[model samples]
Target: MDPFADTLQRLREAFDSGCTRPAEFRAAQLKGLSRFLQENKQLLQEALAQDLHKATQLDSAFIRKEPFGLVLVIAPWNYPLNLSLEPLVGALAAGNCVVLKPSEVSKSTEKVLAKVLPRYLDQSCFAVVLGGPQETGQLLEHKFDYIFFTGSPRVGKIVMAAAAKHLTPVTLELGGKNPCYVDDNCDPQTVANRVAFFRYFNSGQTCVAPDYILCSPEMQARLLPALQSAITRFYGEDPQSSPDLGRIISEKNFQRLRGLLSCGHVAIGGQTDESDRYIAPTVLVGVQETEPVMQEEIFGPILPIMNVRSLDEAIEFIRRREKPLALYAFSNSSQVVKRVLAQTSSGGFCGNDGFMHMTVASLPFGGVGASGMGSYHGKFSFDTFSHHRACLLRRPGLEKVYALRYPPHTPRNLRVLLAAMETRSCSCALL
Candidate 1:
């Protein structure tokens, strides 16, 4: 079925009708969205918990921020509402019509977003569509002014290629195997705690979450016990039963994570429960660079540790791969942290922390190279959905003044014009 055709046509008609052109209308839509969140807080949370096995609160600014006509947002399942609504909010606030395609992998939350969300907003300005891969392929066949996609790099390529056909501008917020380097000079417990909290949060499904660690073999040995202590303290001996802990989002993901457990020596928690889709807060040591775990982005609660002799090697290793969405380094030494910061390239970087850079609204969030391109959050989001149109209004009465260089090939006129330009330049330089 061409499920998107009718809805897209309707939205195009609405945009052409100029109903979404007013600042007042845009504000009303944003206000309606705020009301929707306030009223359906519990429902949204429940849906998130049901779909991703966890719930987290999301915690936006203005520019000339003109909208890009109709925008398509393709969100991932891990943070369904967050990924979907973050872009949607920007598109609407910038005065653009939006079509949200919530991930069908998180069917529960997708239903909530598709069904209940529209009630609070003007239907003509916004719509939510539901689909998996095939339907998404069909949806991409139509043209949109802007497309914001968040998913794996493999699929990000597909989205970019599809958008290329229509020459549609796009923002790809794709995932990569984010790297976290632990310096030998740091506190093991602190590093372990920070790494564990982020790696295991929402079962480690975050796109920006640290995927693996690189440290000296001695540091790796030191980190193991500290990480064990941290995990035990955070989730207890039985992490599976902890209320704060989360389960894998699907059986397929659980199986894939289970397969990765075999790649390295399991230094901490390797238990899995098929019934609940639970994988313990795990840390693997003696992991090779070529292993399956190292080859892909582990979007689960599994952290693999690869040994490196020194910081130089670590930076070189990181630089060799596709630049990740997020990068982290833990060091009490300011010089050491600064060295890594200056030497590496990533969408975002954090020192002595794990992906906390993303929490700050002032810094833009995105990736470089294969990780992805473009950024959003705060002013970046508003700008992402807007086209920076150049506007210059000159006085029409300057025809005589502008005619000096217009036609006559005279040396006198050329010299005079050059002198005038040089005089203006010198005057500005003095100021």
Candidate 2:
């Protein structure tokens, strides 16, 4: 059978077989996932390194634990293991069936997961499907009780559209140009340091990574130097050798980033060695919105900084663009903070911080509009997969009380009915 038919049959059969509802069963599956991650940490970490230029273990370990307890994570290619397994841990804990779908582009990591999870958990209850477009296409054809997708917004739309056909609830953790605002009141050094770290992580191939920076002309002048110093402190002068920095994922990604650099003048670190797949951490200034890099997601080590006349200009710039998946403001002024928060619509906003908000685990991390739809993290993932079946059993004692309003047309009965139903709690809630 095809993956879709198999998965649907299995999930449906499992439900009908009374296999998924027991707390003990769910607890056991969750525990197995946690132990699986702890035991196989190094193997998975190494595979990500081989696939994507860098395999940052800290983020990997953080996301892995999510699925072990109570989440069903469907992670994407950019940060495969961290995104995929983290939410799975959360689902396992919540006692839900976990059916994961890893990206097809990264075949190596997919192979590793297909072998590992089944060895640790009961294959019947917790299973993962490894296939390409054909299988994934089929998997979606059947309605998942809940779905979590992290990718580009274009694909997010397709996922949501398909989900709507089944009336299946979904959470799409998608990407858009996440904005970073640098207000004049903020400490230039602190703000730039934070921005540079996140902007360059994974060579900027991240959903929450700040896509561009907005600032006043005066602060813009000061911010770049501070950002340079922070980059040096973190990665050192010889960034290629620095353990903190890593390479681009593949030749295609290297070319894609290299192509964007061609459209504008290189402000800093424009050098790249194609054979090495090393694009030096670069920064660009004086870039226009029409520039090739500005027109697309600069998901590379290249950081593009733009100057805005005032805070209002920055907000307007954002408003004109698609609603971003994540929005960030770095300001000490409470007024600016309130204004931006109230004026803007983003999937999530980090006040005086960058991507640290996603680490909270307690908060639902997902996007809105062009960024994506739905949300998953912690309890959000568990709820995403299971249907909330509300129950109301009618009691024998309430039958006569409700019957008078069914068919009577008398004025006396109408008056009596209005009096009886005047109580707030009397509406169908009593059943």
The most accurate candidate by TM-score is 1
Score residue 201 of candidate 1 by CA lDDT: 93
Flag regions of model 2 displaced more than 4 Å. Answer: 1-73, 90-96, 419-431
| TM-score, structure 1 vs. true | 0.83
lDDT of 1 by residue, 1-431 (tens): 99999999999678645578678999999999989987997899789869976430000012244688999999999998888888888788888999999999998999999999999999998899887899999999999999999999999999999999999999999989999999999899999999999999999999999999999999988899999999999999899889999889898999999999999799899998999999999999889999999999999999999999999999989987888999999998999888888777799998988888888989888888898889999888888899987433344564665576565536676556655554332131100
Q: In model 2, how many backbone clashes occur?
A: 23
What value of lDDT does candidate 1 attain over all alpha carbons? 0.87
TM-score of each: 0.83, 0.77
Clashes of 1: 0
Question: How well is each residue in 77-151 modelled by candidate 2, as lDDT tens digits?
Answer: 878888888667656655667788888766778788888867999776787887766877777787666667777
Question: Which regions of candidate 1 are displaced past 4 Å?
Answer: 1-65, 419-431
